[model samples]
Target: MTADTAKNFGPAFKTNWWARAGWLAGFLYAAYAANYLDVSWARFLQGLGNGAAFLAEMVPPNFSRWELLAANLIETVEIAIIASAFGILFSLPVGLLAARNLMPSWITWPFRAFIALCRSFHPVIFAILFVKAVGFGPLAGILTLIFASIGFIGKLFTEAIEEISLKPLEALRAAGAPFMSVIIYAVLPQVLNRFIGFSSYQLDANLRNSTMVGIVGAGGIGGTLFAAFQRFDYDFLAAILISIIALVMLSEFISTRIKRVFQ
Candidate 1:
């Protein structure tokens, strides 16, 4: 509207040649990959035909073996809850230590690196490693989800801590309050609600991952689902899929409620 405002705003769009070149490179690479992979229209149509036949086999779910399904579902829920509890406990101190605004460089560096290491691998990869290390059982799944939760929750917690107002902390220190006292009084009050929200979200994620880890013999409903696939029991597979969907939806409902209550 005004000359000064127009001058400050400059042009509506600013061209960055480097960003343009990067996008062009990405598009070129995608095209090259598609060509190399032989992704043709004919093959896509043929795959769709095959998928239609596969869906025909899955038409009425079989819940005849409800006992086994229930047991595995219970195990999956247990693994998620246990992993979430342990992950929350372990991440609390690690996250605090990794907050650069709150801790020294020497302390933050190691903790931050540890969090990065936890995040570097996918939960499936961690599950496979733990399966080999701990033998085939729920222990492996628990460990995988725990590390996954720590990576996610710890990183977010550190960021939240960093963004907190430092005035309360400064006042506490000036008043000769103990370090733990200062943290308990100042740092936590600002981030507790956010931490609860993060914990609930991580729990939901863990529930889904718990089912997947069982595919590698980590112990849950995924093992049953994999068996159904291997046996060509599409009806049973359909039942398991429905069950997993229900589990995820239920977890989502609970997570939303928790966030609302805390808010």
Candidate 2:
């Protein structure tokens, strides 16, 4: 190689003092937080013993209350389905509007801000607010999951739209097609698979969250589970937990199959 080229390709190693200082600061802060929180080996050992005793109490699961269990499961499933449907429907337009590549800044900024606001709070917090507004019931749970779905699926959909090739879009636009027609022919087809994937995943997540929202009086199996915990009904709590696990697994399997079929 020429001397100039060799010099250009010289060793690419350098020490970053800022990175070293950042790491040191992070370690120091972590140590301080641990001390502030009173975290120690003794506390960990005590927690382990308490956890073991609790597990022992939950040895046998009881499910004699089949009617109650079935009713609550059905309600939870309904909440998830309804929320997923509405959330997906509403998110499509919002997502398209929010795609920076497709829309002008005037259009994209507001929708982007809305999506951000939706995602700023956790579902449980939303459930609390909805419960206060709508009173305790499945309605509150549905609203909570709907916003959660919109926030998550909308962001992903916007990203998917942005990543699509602009060639097809340009071709359709050149053909003097209306805006909706262009979306149908050029945009939807390209992002359909990913949209389906995101929808399915959101549905699964909604199902899990539906169960928990009930704890805050949003209405689902969570209320029952919370009651069991308060009453120290360990066997019943075990049964409820097992049922939730089974439901989550079943939803995952179904979603996987649906994705495979579409693929």
Candidate 3:
């Protein structure tokens, strides 16, 4: 190209005016929000000091109530396991029904809406409702996690089914296979690995959420932990926190192993 023609060309990099405006608007809105909330450097520094003091009080954690801790931990595990099983079992049919490629729009719509409803609220909110309805305990916790697992894994499961190659499904249908047989022979194999992965991940999530639901009286270690905090038993609270951390880590490790085995 001639030097004059090259010079007439615009710069290699062009500015995105819309993006710049969006960023500026976002920054201005953030500043406005901070101002509206009365956020200040003085309060921030005070919060830091209070946080440091709280950390100091958490040292040398106490686990004196080992019996109580063990009982609640067991309850949490039970809630997680039962909820995971129920979620996986129920999600399969609902997910299959929701898959647009498999089921008609008329059939998928209601199931899809149900899944959306399940996912609309946080687990804690569900726990609160269940606690009120059931009058508290592990049953409430289990029910809460079950719906949560359905909301999460069900959507993924539908996507997984939808994404499967249709050739195998068509071949099975052409070979005079029944719909159920096609699902068993053609659909399940294609999506089994993904389904297992989703279930394991959901189980891990249920375990973590199970601990928190107890705070709302759904039943678990969270209730004990909340009581400790209310009584200002920082050492006991520290122990409970540590135990929850350890439980979560252990669940993560187990989930990883399960995924590896499937892979």
Candidate 4:
């Protein structure tokens, strides 16, 4: 091979042994896990057959109890709205406080830790705890989702703040603007679009999650859906799934419009 060609292909800049080894290790681990878990083609085929049978049962969706279904769906939307509203509101300050670029470590650390703590638990667990505390209803679901939103929204907002350019901030400070003024003029302008996007996305997520929290009796459509499942009311369950699909699509349309307006 020519000298230049050899140089071009040399391991000095091209080698990434660590990465290759990591990939190999991951592949091996996945194979071992599958074997350990008894993941066989026969088992998979059996599962598929079972799933097909289930799907057959769910066909011909029944909305005979449309009144009850409608009430639960509305309650789910209400939970999502209330949770998203309060969560997004609270997340703003939490995000601001956690921004390492703007706040000192002492100030940022506690807030960051708190957000971390909020994120550590899954929404179902939070729903369970709140349900126990409040003794069932939409309030428990609302509280659960609020904490979930703060965790997700707070982290994203903190990251958005950290990614903002420091130039405007420096200029505003040089111009002797107060702390709040600096944030108002220099910070908000940059991240407002992203913040709105995050909030709307969280609202969308809360809507889906609200439906699930109800399974635990925290409120929404989940309890009804679960009961239907137990009673082998697969037709009704199918209707609920279709309604949820509609709800999500509606949210998606709204989110697109809101994003377009901001853009």
> Which candidate has the top score in TM-score?
3
Instruction: Name the lDDT value of residue 145 in candidate 3.
Output: 95
Instruction: Give candidate 1's whole-model lDDT.
Output: 0.94
Query: Candidate 4: minimum summed lDDT over ten consecutive residues — where?
Result: 6-15
**How does model 1 score by TM-score?**
0.90
Clashes of 4: 1
TM-scores for candidates 1 onward, in order? 0.90, 0.89, 0.92, 0.87
**CA lDDT of every candidate:** 0.94, 0.94, 0.94, 0.95
Q: Write the per-residue lDDT of candidate 2 for residues 71-171, one digit (tens) a residue.
A: 99999999999999999999999999999988999999999998998889999999999999999999999999999999999999999999999999999
Which wins on lDDT, candidate 1 or candidate 2?
1
lDDT of 3 by residue, 1-263 (tens): 77776689866678899999999999999889989999978999999999999999999898898889889899999999999999999999999999999999999999999999999999999999999999889999999999999999999999999999999999999999999999999999999899999999999999999999999999889899899999999988999999999999999999999999999
Candidate 3, TM-score vs. the true structure? Answer: 0.92
Q: How far does residue 246 in candidate 2 sit from its true spot (Å)?
A: 0.7
Better structure of 1 and 3 per TM-score = 3
Candidate 2 vs 4: which has more TM-score: 2
User: Which regions in candidate 1 have their CA more than 4 angstroms from the true location?
Assistant: 1-29
lDDT of 4 by residue, 118-140 (tens): 89999999999999999899999
Candidate 3: the clashing residue pairs are: none
Kindly report which residue stretches of model 2 are placed more than 4 angstroms away from their true locations once superposed.
1-29
Q: Candidate 2's error at 148, in angstroms?
A: 0.4
